[model samples]
Target: MVLDTQIKAQLQQYLTMLEGDLVLKISAGEDKTSRDMVELVTELEKMSPRITVEHVQLERTPSFSVNKVGEDSGVVFAGLPLGHEFTSLVLALLQVSGRAPKVDEAVIKRIQAIQEPLHFETFVSLTCHNCPDVVQALNIMAVLNPNITHTMVEGGTFQDEVKAKDIMAVPTVFLNNENFAGGRMEIEDILQKLGSKSDGTEFANVEPFDVLVVGGGPAGASAAIYTARKGIRTGIVAERFGGQVNDTLSIENIIGTKVTEGPKFVASLEGHVADYDIEVMKSQRVAHISRKELVEVELENGAVLKSKAVILSTGARYRQLGVPGEEAFKNKGVAYCPHCDGPIFKGKNVAVVGGGNSGVEAAIDLAGIVNHVTLLQRGNELKADRVLQERLRSLPNVTVLTNALTQEITGTDKVNGLTYVDRVSGQEHHIELEGVFVQIGLLPNTEFLRGTIDVNAHGEIIVDKHGATSMPGVFAAGDCTDTVYKQIVISMGSGATAALGAFDYLIRHTAPTQELVGV
Candidate 1:
């Protein structure tokens, strides 16, 4: 059964409180996933008396159906509910049980205002941690509004449909059969795109700011707080507030605390930044930037903003494996975030790509939970610290493969094996495993600024110790810059330094604002 004792206990607690008879009618076929689905629901039935799962044998192969006891709910899952979409399945069950997902009243109202019926078929894999946020948001919207229907289509189970749609990524949303969004979108982004208020503004109508922080992560938040405290008209425009921090699962390195999760930490960050009078603009990505009198920042949504000084904190994202089956089995067995997805592969064999510190650390972490780990390194030796390698060597279940190049991720519905080539032997080998953790490296999000500002060879923005960029009025911070460390505390420190640097530049270069001369 996929549901472990811990998850079963958790489901028991939730389903025990279930108000109504939550009947899950599951139809499975001849495929292996179909059998897996049957096993999963059979285990769920044993969790709580309120949860009654019925197994309907399907004549066809690989196709399945799951729905509540009602006819008009218009909510269902056509595949197995595992991985990150597991969140969607659980939340949807809770919603059907008369419990609502946590959402703001303002957002609920905005969702209710949608005039036309919108069906959001969000294609997702079970391992995608970011997919849950969008799926949960849309599910809550469906619960709030009768005009909306949201379905989580597990990409692995439904390959024919995924191929038909030409979907290359998880979290790709099809709004009413049209391509709506591409990647991780905030709740605000979903609302605005569907039918909420306009997210764009004319450059002339927009108010000027003394400083504008382009990102809303720890760095951007810290920068905006520091700049606004100086009594200057400071603003921030971010694609999302938390940025890469939200993707992080466990955070123990922040000096003050022993441990904290990503979501709660980001919520605290938003609350902390709310105390100041900062013009926070969430759910906006910068399209381009140019210096015309002031730094002109144009958004993908067609809005243009002007600021005297700017701090770049766009942050970095995890690099992909670019191998076959890597995209298709992303959440199934091929994963990127070990912290976020390591637990999903408990008691299962897995492999890790790269020999860096992150890869070795991930192997060490996963070894405690999973049955075994096979680490593949392209280099002759481990790039991680000697201590880390020693610790990894201490683990009996962990195996290290040096000078290996990952060739393909092999699996049908769920990832069960990986093929890699030995660089020295010039021979290919296959390892049977459930998961692949890719920890090669990170690429900064600074390609938009080709040469507007100086950047390192790795595309990271070049900034001084004070967080000042090569340009006079511009500064940079966080993972997007050439900072040695890419942690939260370091990014926050750099952000504050950038704000202070921008403030100093403004004081020396720009004229002071005229005070009111009225009686």
Candidate 2:
């Protein structure tokens, strides 16, 4: 029989009243409440006795034992048992009943086998909620394996510890006495590190380098070439061969190249750097960076590297719309890269926010494919080049709305429409569309270098004419740095300059003096 809505509502109310810091006890074969149950029932009986309370029947089985008190003694209730509140409930229940949930046998065995307690402390802040997932995963591991004692320390509370660990961002997990995971981490990755069974079969010794380039973008690749050609032992560390340029649709101005797609041009640049004897470590992230006599870098997988100088070439990410429903409908209907998701919305209406070069280019590109393009601008005019502005104005399918702001994205499951406010008229209107592309600009990924170097108010790393920052033995190049002209050609030129500056610093500091014996 189906339960009536009124009865369900009443049952839910009864369950809500039952939840509190109280111990519940149960006994068998009695219609009336037992003494322990009566105490709990008496407390909650005033709230709602009609909710139903009865003695549970014990099963007659050989496996069951009387020594285990809670054969049928515990409170069963509704509502999702989750979050911090649920953890408190579980602890409370265990205190009264003297029984905990059964853990995995293999995991328990592994915990018992561990000789030492693995102390893991992860620093996190409410501003960085993304860290909680990592913390929760580690907590689960701690539960399964008692050998691991994990603690989540709020970064703001421990200001001294944060300064000591150089905690720039959240999700920084420290394993044992070493900094383990920095950013987002996978479960298997942490597990492998804890359970490494290697016999040094995949190990290799690397020599110390004069300078190490940490990215292979236009700036980083160029830095490696210039440093290597100058007779310095240079190395390049890149998660990808070409960095963000590989995702660009087209590149028009790279000095020699008039018109080239991002991937092909980046491939050529990679080849140019690969011709030298410099070591290239692709698909790797620098997990830890420390300075002693020589700067030391630790890879994500525990490989150690030493260098005299280091260059940060990590670029930036596309700025998000930050409007409601933008993140909810991210891949389904909302997108940042027009070239990546534009084709899917062909013959469909789409809205492009931001009137900059990327936004104007996206509008021009979408006008050809989409049924109609609404170009919304927060200001009176577009901020792109004159040529691009002229091209956008000439498109018949593109409608440029000046002094317009996207107030909110209206969609239940995916993107269906958008609400925009007219800045000039103070009128709000909803546009029925299938997709929205946000190209507001870019945000520097210099979060990793927060206290390491000087950054401008806009969060871009501050550098001099030669791409040298205020920090000694450290340099920054590409979009990460505060260069007014953010073009491919300019990045390459700055990268070359930074490389030369690094070379000079290395020679002056490390090279030995010559007595001029020939003279």
TM-score of every candidate relative to the true structure? 0.71, 0.59
lDDT string, candidate 1, 36-95, tens digits:
877877776777676777665543333333345564344556677776567677777778
RMSD of 1: 7.6
C-alpha lDDT of all candidate models, in order: 0.79, 0.65
In model 1, where is the ten-residue run with the lowest total lDDT? Answer: 510-519
Across 234-305, the per-residue lDDT of candidate 2 in tens digits comes to: 898876667667657688777776898775677699789879978877656666666678877777667777
Candidate number with greatest lDDT? 1
Deviation from native of the Cα of residue 243 in model 2, angstroms: 1.8
Candidate 1 backbone collisions, by pair: 83-126, 84-126, 127-331
